[model samples]
Target: MGNKKNLFTLAYAKKFLNKKGLELFKKSNQTRSSNSFKSLSYTVLSSLILIIIFFSSPIINNFKNNLITQSIEVTNNSKNKLENVLTGKAIENEQNDKLDILQIFEDIFQYEDKSTSTVRLSASTIEQLFKDTKYNLKDVRKNKL
Candidate 1:
């Protein structure tokens, strides 16, 4: 009786598996093949892009070098023409104009007098000053003040 029951169970299991399990396995295999094909295509695309960039790099570099050389030549020619056009008096006047501009900036930014004193406060003094106020260092830092 046990042998018959076991055989019946085995037969039912085999039938159930044959109906659903085979389809599941076939679908999984198809998905795996599709995933592999996608990966292969991505790899080929990336390799082609890399190959294109590699082949074009020299051309890009040569173009950049030519632009740089042309700019340098242009600047050199401009400098030569400027030097030829400017006499000694004009060069001296240009230098004087540069000095006057520097002087103006210095005059705008310079302190009025060296007699003005800067008071140095210690950390304890700073803390004491803030202790009376509503704002503490932490609050000030948090508020970005």
Candidate 2:
């Protein structure tokens, strides 16, 4: 019985293959091979890129460190020049003026919350609260939030 079934299946497959022609089969095989080749090439390209970045990371870090050190040295030189031209008392007064300005800004923007009340609502109540508003779930979903 199994042999008969296998032979029937094979005969049907052969008939179908003949109807489709060898050209179609060849084209599909070529397409599959090209797709695999493309995937392999992409994998190799990405690996090469990662390897290059890995090998060059120390050089990049050294360049960044050089830039940071140069900036620190420049700032130190500028600070020394300023100190040379200014008296101690003048520098102390300048720092005091900066602190006073910062304090004024802090006072203007200071916030204190003293609320001690708590309110809780059920799911239905929450739904009702948003039923007539644009903040409903439907609107939120439409807005992709």
Candidate 3:
């Protein structure tokens, strides 16, 4: 932290990191009890990491659950409305709020992807797909809504 010099430039940063790595490697060979600061730094860093991991789980899980709940509700409401409309029951009830197509689209757009699946595409393949005709997503989604 001396003078807070700009050590972040690519080459300088790499050299600084490599130097720090060698210093830590050398320092670790010394008796752990002798260099209390070294051991303390390691302990503090590890504890901080563990604390972050512990505290963040509940918050992340809650957000994920809320999104899943919303998606499920949207799916169910769309299914029920489609059934009613198809059965010739016109929804004349103005009190009942109709689903917002844009909201559904936004939800899908901002969706939390939990998929662990890996997909690989080559550059030419991606370029070909990019050149393909873009279809209206609204048309298909609107039919369900």
* Candidate that scores best on lDDT: 1
Which parts of model 1 are misplaced by more than 4 Å? 1-30, 71-145
- Model 1 C-alpha RMSD vs. true structure (Å) is 14.1
Candidate 2 stretches with Cα past 4 Å from truth are: 6-11, 17-41, 69-145
Whichever of 1 and 2 has more TM-score, that candidate is 2
Best by TM-score: 2
Error of 2 at 14 (Å): 3.7
Error of 3 at 4 (Å): 63
- Local distance difference test values of all predictions, in order: 0.72, 0.71, 0.72
Candidate 1: tens digits of C-alpha lDDT, residues 27-111: 4535678899999999999999999999999999999888766653322355655786774334323233345777877886685
Question: Residue pairs in steric clash, candidate 2?
Answer: none
Q: Model 3: residues >4 Å from true position, as ranges?
A: 1-34, 68-145
Native RMSD of candidate 3 (Å): 25.1
Tell me the tens digit of each residue's lDDT in model 2 across 1-145: 8787556565577678788873323445356788999999999999999999999999999998887666533224557558766755343232333457777777766733434486889999878878856477877779874
Query: Candidate 2: lDDT of 97?
Result: 33
Per-residue lDDT value at 55 in model 3: 100
Worst 10 residues of 2 by lDDT: 89-98
Q: Candidate 1 — which pairs collide? A: none
- Order of candidate numbers by lDDT, starting with the best: 1, 3, 2
Which of the two, 1 or 2, has more lDDT?
Answer: 1
